[model samples]
Target: MTKLETAFAPVAPAVDLDAYFARIGYDGPREPTLAVLRAIHQKHPDAIPFENIDVLLGRPISLDPAAIDAKLIGAGRGGYCYEQNGLLKRVLAALGFQVEGRMARVLWMAPAGAPPRPRSHMVLAVRVPGDDAAWLADVGFGGCVLTAPLALFSDDVQATPNGDFRILPIDELGGERQVQADLSGRWSPTYQVASGAWADVDYEQANFYTYAHPSSHFTFSLTAGRTTPTARYALKNNRLTHRDATGALVDQRDLSAAELEAVLRDVIGLPVEPDWRPLLEKIVAWGSAA
Candidate 1:
């Protein structure tokens, strides 16, 4: 069997491949390069949802391909990096693309001189045929996600409905990279990929830190979001912010604890059990206080 087939063969045992593809809106001939990407973008919104439901419930996040597939594709749930991007990497590889799992440190730019703090984030780099630079594909980030693959050297601004994005080299930090959108000129720091080759195990270890660390934002927030052509629906803490097509913040409403739980189940389409209602209430309470 080919490397690609072998990597994903085990995934099928745990997940129905056809059902998984249908869940993500993937329906086309298997073309590793661009077809899979377009399928994901068409079906799944750019803003996937980085949530801490499992963390709050004391369930350890699994980095295994089958486990991720079970949570996302099988159970009809959304997840953070380890679950979202990790599964995307497997799917890409199974479609014959050269995929690498990478870790990124988040650096959020602030107004008036606030410093950037590093947080753990996960993404993937894929080497497509006839392409010199690896394309960054991520379906896990809460707000900003690439709708299409980006060339490594090009600084040309790629426009998404949400914002304009570009990646440029950072010389000051010893070759660190920065990706920025029109929303902020201050570039958000993603991962610094090592020149040497990385094994899947390397990403597995990094995934552990991201999900298990107390400092990770995924540990703190039950954030979920979805992006449409004209607007964005984001559930951050107890407040939901809707940004319009013109990049204006259109609406921001704070929800009560009970209302927040209802929104999660009714609006966002996440299935919450009776036992989980209290946890959702706790998250809403924390969000209100924050």
Candidate 2:
């Protein structure tokens, strides 16, 4: 093992190669190279969706590596940032890539001039082999996730299967940056990232606030996203929104409980247990009441 591996050997979850490869439908190279990084970035999100099912079900979302593997990789369940990014970290590390833990403030949904949002969102800073600069990679953003890795440098438009993406420098002096998605000639800010070496406790605290806080939207509503080469789709509460390859919002509609179940099972390819459907009924009823 390398020095980095020796240091992380204890904390990193042992990845089940068979299971993870199957989950992402990727059977290609796992070298610590840019090509592998981009391929994994594209395929991983296409397979494991960005979802908050546990939070919506009023259950505590576990950030423990083993628990994440059991729920996401083993059982094929999806998760929010803390869980989803956590899994990606392990997989990349197990594949021999140097992955750093970082946190970002979610500014996309924030109101202008509002107090700065917490650095709650987690991201991976990767050191791909044969590359001079590190790369920013994430698979946990439920609304707009990058289907390709972006260079850490700023302002250049990066291409992804989902859309044209970029991370523009917001405060060059302060090293603050924002990720943007190009949608029909409009650049939509996804989130702002600041410089910080995020620690494990930071992620735990963020997960607590996002998953357990009564005021958090994840606690009361559902948010799920899936990406494909042809389209990207999101489920927010009862609303299902679809965007085509060009980043044009193609479809938006409310889903009935039965329809929601079908989307979960078919569109997202989640194996929704029979009993889970009843809980979904409650969720739909609760949404209507809300």
Candidate 3:
């Protein structure tokens, strides 16, 4: 087997369930019910955060369960989608929930008339024991992240802790769906999710591109986001922004080098490495020019 395949080999939950629960500060029911999923969906991002620091640091993103557990759970660091959702997949599976991986073409900030982007974003389709219908769960969408799973079979608007969301079918057969969120009275297309089976190799390939491709935004930018019950915090380069639960901007500011480090460590709750000082300086300088 290839390295990626081996790293992703199916095994009993490699992540310690207790460690994961503690990492997210979740003490709710362990059952694979919608309530438990919702509780975790909200708590995961709030505690673990979403970040691309490893990509910016030129580190290969690993899908090995041990590595994910060590970095995100044990080491007090955050990661982008693959790590975030991949870990969630294992945890949910360990909890006896049926989980499937899915990919999406991100349209969150795509300019008008831009060519269709690749399917680079990762999400989950989950099935509870008693429910026949599936739900969409994703905790790695950065600033506008979802705090609850959206029903896969419904086109109706679903309410989450972050904001209201709707899953719109793109075709008559429902082979594809568009994920939209209500943003300040406007329903914006966040991404188009494809109804297809996804494998570990697919995630590894997409992760490789995200961390290594020059065109990938994760490789060039510094981004960290955390969603709390009251507000959502986003840090891009050196700009720190806060938006209330209603998607209204609360405040935004450019940070200096010291302030940038402080925000990453304190506000975002990332273990900002001392070795990242130089890179943090560059981020601050770029933010000033932008």
Candidate 4:
């Protein structure tokens, strides 16, 4: 099968279910229904952090399932969007969620007057059993990702444990929906998404550009993210930010080497790979990241 056809092609739920469930510390039902979806969604970010350490180090990321599993699940490391969502796609399909791989154009960090960012982001269009409406589930986006799947409605307010998220229809192109996020109360253009049945090759190309190109922020900055029931925590470079229930900044500070290391290990649950220990120190060390 071509990569596009295999991107999220539902064949059989034969993925290692027991291992995935164990990884997420989820003891919930796996009945291929929306309830299971919600249970899995809520537990994922709590267990797996969103990070891009390998990319920043110029390690060639392979989208191969085995590589993703080994790095993220086996190595106790975290990954950025593609790795996170790619792993989720397999797990959701293995559970019979009828999920498809999708792409989005990011605008969250676009420079003013700069063209819309590339369709570098990955999203999932899921068909929940017994529901007429499809839902958008993304466990990848770092800054303000969906902690729970949102019903794919343009104006409906969806509540998540971390914050309120609502999608607004911006423009439609060739039957695809253009949506933006209403994070807290601010409006920011998100990405234009489609059923996006292209190829794993397409995703790999985008992932390559982000990590290989100098202009891409992921190539240079250090970032990590995790969401809890009460708040969201994000660490970019050496600056750490914590937002409360209302998406208000509860804490923001430049973390010292000790402090940043603690947050990465304890809060984000990512252990330093022995080879990257020195790099990690220099990246988060006082005054060096600046």
Candidate 5:
């Protein structure tokens, strides 16, 4: 094992490859080729969604590979960045891909002059053997998740199943990279990736802050997102919104409490837990009072 792999070995267990494949409905090749990577990347988010229900419920988020597998795959539940990309990290490694963990500060939807956020988002740097360029494989970014891998250093626009994205140099020294997406003719920053690859400890610390910190939005809001071949779905509180592949709004509506439950279960494809109702109730009630 490589030093990075050895360092992460203890905490990272081999994912249930068969179960994961079945969950994503992916029957493609298992090689670490770009084609295989693209296929899996596209299918993962379509199957497993991005959500923060556990955080909102005041439950601790565990980064153990086994724990992530049990909750996300076994229970058919969705999770936030740490859980989503962390699980993907193992799955890709098991498939013989040279996958490394990376961190990013989210700039998506932030005010123009707001302070920089913490490095709470998790993304993957994947090196396909014999491929000269590294590919950014992230299926964790909500609302605007990447459905296909993009060349890590490329500044040109790259198209995916969901939308168009580009990674541009943000610093004069070229130490920082910014990920942007074309949202209806307007390019918007999603997150800025730090220079080096992240270690296991980095994920643990970031994951903790993302779920536990008072300033973290995950603690208070009910958010879930997923992408399909044709459209993207984003749900916040009692509102569910849908956008087309071109990043144009297709349809959006406020969902009732019962409708929220149904949408979480059916639309978002999460195996809704009974205990989540009280939290969901609070979300609906909060929205009603607003």
Candidate 6:
């Protein structure tokens, strides 16, 4: 078997590549660049959950393509960017797209007009046929990420059911790229991209830090998320918040352990293992104490 196939060979819940494609609403021949992005986004808020369950359980996050495939495709789990986007790079390459794995420093909106800080994030640069340039596609970020690939230079408005988004060039970092969204006209910073090339091993080390570091948010919160056509659901620590299409706060609640697990399985569609319960309890207790 090829390296890519072997990597995903152990994927459980059986990916059913055809069914998975159908699940994502794609029924056409592969477009290489477009198909991979669409599948990830459509499957994303469904298949891979946005959760930090593994970290709270003391499990190491693996950046291996096969390992990620097993966790996400086999076990029906969701992961953060390193795991989500890393595996996506492999899938795109396997499908014959011109794929480059790139890293980004996250510079989201801060409280006091401080400069955007760097957080380890990953995205893909895909070159498509009949197109002179590549596009930026990200399906891994929990919230406020793109559902479709955007042209690199054009300032076109790509409208999602939720809101409008645009990609613009950042000259401060020597022609680096930044993705901005209409956060009520505030133009919030989502992520910063550059022309740097990255490899699987590079992401492996970064994933280790985010999952294991005391300062990383994953170490403290039990979070899971998925995006819907009209709203976004996220479980952060003990509070569950739902945001509507106009970026309005729709609902919020505190969940018990059983409720959390049910949401993980039923709402996010991820398979919950028996061991995850104890971790969930610990997270709940931690939240209650804090």
lDDT of each: 0.66, 0.83, 0.91, 0.77, 0.89, 0.71
Q: Estimated TM-score per prediction?
A: 0.83, 0.91, 0.94, 0.88, 0.94, 0.83
Q: List residue ranges in candidate 5 displaced over 4 A.
A: 1-12
Alpha-carbon deviation at 251 in model 2, angstroms: 1.0
TM-score of 6: 0.83
CA RMSD, predictions in order: 4.1, 2.6, 3.8, 3.5, 2.2, 5.1
lDDT for model 6 comes to 0.71
Residues 1-22 of candidate 3 have per-residue lDDT tens digits of: 9999999776645669899999
Q: Of 3 and 5, which scores higher on lDDT?
A: 3
Native-to-model Cα distance after best TM-score fit, residue 152 in candidate 1, in Å: 2.8
- Number of backbone collisions per candidate, in order? 0, 0, 0, 2, 0, 2
Identify the superior model by TM-score, candidate 2 or candidate 5. 5
- Candidates 1 and 2 compared: the better one by lDDT is 2
lDDT of 3: 0.91
Give per-residue lDDT, candidate 4, residue 107: 71
Q: How much is 65 displaced in model 1, in angstroms?
A: 1.3
| Poorest stretch of ten by lDDT in candidate 2 | 193-202
Query: Once model 4 is optimally superposed onto the true structure by TM-score, how far is the C-alpha of residue 201 displaced, in angstroms?
Result: 3.1
lDDT of 4 by residue, 74-120 (tens): 88777877888888888988777777778888777567799767678
Candidate 4: regions farther than 4 A off: 1-14, 130-132, 176-184, 285-290
Query: What is candidate 4's local distance difference test score?
Result: 0.77
Q: What would the per-residue lDDT of candidate 5 be over residues 142-167, giving only the tens digit for each residue? A: 88999999998988999998889999
Residue 191 CA displacement from its true place in model 4, Å: 3.2
lDDT of 6 by residue, 121-170 (tens): 88888876656677776777776656667666666766665667777877
Show pairs that collide, candidate 5.
none
Question: lDDT score of model 5?
Answer: 0.89
